[model samples]
Target: MAQITKAGLTFPIMNSGNRHGEVSGEPLPILMRYWRARRNPRDIPALPQTVRRATGLTQQDVAYLAGVSVRWYRQLENGVAADYSADLLDRVATALDLSPAERATLYLRAVGRPPTPYSPLQEDTAECWDQDLLQLFVDNQEPMPSYATDLSWNVVAHNLTLRRWFPWAAHGANLMRWVFLEPEARQHLVNWESDWARPFLGQLRYERAHHPANAALAQLERAILAGSQDARELWHRREVVEHSHGAVRRLRLPYHQGQEVTVRMVTVRPLRTVALCVNLLVECANPGGPSAS
Candidate 1:
């Protein structure tokens, strides 16, 4: 864990943790240099004036709410400003009353990073409607279990089939919370040591790095940390997983015989950039043989 300095920036060199057993690192200053040299936060799109009009707030009023000077806020909204900290962006997001998805976008923009762009989620504010749509989609899967989840894994929708397959899904329906909080599910995770914690921990780390002020997300994170040493250790790693695609595992599933269900989770990123993860449970057509890892 030795820290090195270069060009007034600090970085760490660490072990490879692999067969190569090599130590490598990136200089924080260098990454910043590249980011600053090639990046521009001004590229972040401005909040719409119409949205502001709807709020009945003028530019100065909005700036007041955001705790920034009128000129500075104007420059930001005008796309003439560059570089904003997460805290500052959070303040602006609060002023706008942006949804979690919109707030995340603002944070990315403030840091001179472009958000992942995709289509919007279906337009529906009614929770019941969202859940209904989700249920309908997953219900058709039948023996192949699937569930619909919001960005944070709040159980917006799930079929009875999935709920029956994973009883824990019925208990509150928040994926992040349930994964860390459920006693039975916790033990069922084969690698509660790492795999079980890494994905969600990494996802939260990513969210916090940008929207660090989210009280609800922060509270949930602290709660999770309070429960598991593994969660606490993984949180400190500060890694991020986009969860858009690649290998995914269900550590416990009745269909998979409580063995890890190594399934490929497909993600449909709506224009809002919130991930819609679909877990396709592909098991052997024949049943009753020794379960595959």
Candidate 2:
């Protein structure tokens, strides 16, 4: 009698009694069939070959787009590089113009783990805002600078007072874009590096992870990275943090001229909606004072 061990179970071999109740001519177990199929020569393609066939991009093009040297990219495609970081793979995926599914496939083939999936929420911009809630937020805040943002951080609504104060919080202006791309933001935000840029980027990273399929968000990310070297470096760091509330900061308000204003920034979420959040910036009593909101 002969025996074989599979999945920690012992089974009789073909020469022995058939444990699977097969009459001598029956097919192998499903697991064995799958194993055999995986060994088929026609089923697998080299990573370099796949990239060539899938994107029709030259090695030099991929290297330049991914911010890697041509020598390194060639080695990676040829499977000679023993180690590659996920960050590098991500850049390669972006350079190749891969879809979410194709990106997952690339990760699986290269690293043996499927990349995180991105299933963007179906909520449209029109459905993201509630006029009643926006009115309530604006009305209740009175003189405070308050505004609402959708999931993509687009300023959906704001009170007249906020516009009077910042003037740049235009309707539909993306917060990330305004902060990174707008020159006025750099001038106004006193602690642009610590208070605004890094924290805001962490929040954007969280959003990108959760909503990877969002085309607009992806485009915005690309634009920011291309426009700012600092932003690109921070993005590659892969640091993630929650959007903070009740943080106080000094701003060189255009309205206030050279003097800085201490303001307490608070973020709030309305009932039954994950898409809308309200941010309130209330003036502090004294310069460099603790948050009052």
lDDT of each: 0.53, 0.63
Q: Clash number for every model?
A: 5, 0
Regions of model 1 farther than 4 Å from truth: 1-129, 248-261, 272-279, 284-293
- Worst 10-residue lDDT window for candidate 1 reads 118-127
Off by over 4 Å in 2: 1-127, 286-293
Residue 228, candidate 2: Cα error in Å is 1.3
Among the numbered candidates, top lDDT falls to 2
Give per-residue lDDT, candidate 1, residue 265: 52
